[model samples]
Target chain A: MKRSLLPFFAGTATGLANGLFGAGGGLLAVFLLNRCGIDKKSSHATALALTLPLSLISAIILFCWGTTLPLGALCIAILCGLPGAWLGTILLKKISPALLSRMFGIVMIVSAVRMFLR
Target chain B: MNLIALGIAGFFSGICASMGIGGGFVLMLYLTLLAGTPQKEAQLFNLCFFLPIAAFSLWRHRKNGLLCTSPIKPALLGGIPAALAGSLLAAFLPNAQIAKLFAIFLAIIGIKTVFARRESEQSKEERVIRPTQKQ
Candidate 1:
């Protein structure tokens, strides 16, 4: 495949996962972008950008489906989440790669176990 | 078994994500393990699939009074530009690294959930409302 094609494939996967999971798009986007030859800084920025549109689109769909939600609570969460997200970004830089990877693995396993148990 | 299965997955995933637990872990696993897709490909498919579902869920929440633009707006300031850049960056990576990273992220979420207390199970933090002094 041509070098340019590589990015498309990478984008496709990142986009697919983001659309389906509604989480991890940021982290995974960076990983894929980095692998695709994008520098870390650009990859990080791009990954961060993806979150808004993806979340917005998902939120809209939920609305159409008529799922009940806590506007107040979500608002609080969003309010908290922004700072949390910003803080999280800063914190990520402080962690070692090994520990960070371990953290990531543990998160996934817990999520999987919970769903499986559910 | 095709579109229907996909639709159901999206719906369920949407519910979970809106609940703030994240749908990506489950979505990728289902696609890769149950549906027999390769890890890389499953992730690719799920990313696109998640967008609509998440958007709809957030919208639905707003209808139920869950929507708040307050924090989300600030996030958008940073998130939009970052995502575009990330998308562009993804074009150059190798597949193995992606898989490794995905696995790592999953592991972390799983551990946190396991040890973390459910909001319902825990006592709510008290929110203090103080009276203003008379001017």
Candidate 2:
């Protein structure tokens, strides 16, 4: 694939993943951006920049389609999430992400198995 | 107690999500498995949950000089239409089916995470070598 075309394809995949699953788009974005020769930190930040809009669009679409949102839960999550996001952004520069990434991966695998059994 | 637990989970999920890790997975897993939220509904919650957190994180990243703008335009152009299409497809699919597919996706990401080269180490190495090479 042409180097220039990579971002478009990456966006397509990221959008598809986000829209379909309501999550995971950033992971795809980061991976594709890395493949596009972006450094890890930039890839992560840029992925956020990419996925943020995509998620907004998807959320609106999903809501209009009559997906019942748990507004109370959302409020709680967001309220707590704000500070955490702040901390995460700081940590992004201060800490090495390799260990956390692997830990998160392990947690994801465990969660996946649990979901399968449900 | 439940609320506190949810709050804690939300905090951690926020951290991961902001970092461009798959925080949605954490939130989705919590909602569906622990909170007993329906699968599709959980997805919606995850999506809604991301917006504000991402906005904040992006602002922070921009301030920190970590953001790169080069990829935004093309990606958005391709992403918007694809996102709409994918959401339409999801609307048609059964919740159980989406759940199963999500499980598979999670497992794949997990495997990749476990096995992929340590990104921070690579970046560190790059930072070390770039200036020397430029000399």
Candidate 3:
């Protein structure tokens, strides 16, 4: 029963994190899922999967609240991101989880340090 | 919009999101620091930008059977409303305050990531495969 509820709890935290920060929810989800005994690769994929509906919901709420950017800017951002997303997916399949995990750590640390200092 | 900045932001954000690294923070920082976007607006843009890239990544992951369905329902159950509340909260906070909070959050997660231990590739793959076969 407690085990079953882990996903719900994980989701709640993820939604809050993502909605509040506009990013990092997936990382939180992956961390939580990993603790819940999900494998690293699956945790990563699960985090990605969950981010979809969660982000859509958040986007809808932001839209309803009139908090989003203009249409033109939104379009340009998404279009530009498409190629990166495609390339990322290919890389995801090719990369090993251990290496990805290390990279994720480095990215989080470096970015965090930069943000903190600035 | 600075087309070049937008392009770079979008590209990196897409890659990070697809890889489940939560690239939104990076995009947010880039927009705020480099593109001179207001923090509040940058946060909003990150969410919107995340939508398409995340969707695309989800599709690819699902098609490849990388996604595990077991946690989906419960995660949604908890995540959806919390996200809504978080967005509402973000609206009331000051921009600088939000940035500070974001920085702190990033630092914590970063530390956790750095400390996490990973097994060898072969062992990791076996573990993933073993669990899937059981399910």
- Best by the TM-score measure: 2
Task: List runs of model 2 lying over 4 Å from the truth.
Answer: B120-135
- DockQ (model 1, Cα): 0.06
lDDT of each: 0.45, 0.87, 0.79
Greater TM-score among 1 and 2 belongs to 2
Write model 2 residue lDDT over A1-118, tens digit each, in one string.
7778999999999999999999888987887888787888788889999998999988888899899986887899899999999999999988766678788888889988888878
Of models 1 and 3, which has the larger lDDT? Answer: 3
On DockQ, the leading prediction is 2
Model 2 achieves a DockQ score of 0.75
Q: Which scores better on DockQ, 2 or 3?
A: 2
Query: Tens digits of per-residue lDDT for model 3 on A37-68?
Result: 78777788789878777777777766776675
Fill in the DockQ of model 3.
0.67
Question: Model 2 misses residue A29 by how many Å?
Answer: 1.3
RMSD of each candidate? 16.0, 3.5, 4.1
TM-score of chain A of 1: 0.74
What does candidate 3's lDDT look like per residue over B11-86, in tens digits?
8888877877667766876787777777678877888888778888888988777888988888898888998888
Q: Which stretches of candidate 3 lie over 4 Å from their true place?
A: B120-135
Residue A23, candidate 2: C-alpha displacement in angstroms: 1.1
- Worst 10-residue lDDT window for candidate 3 chain A reads A96-105
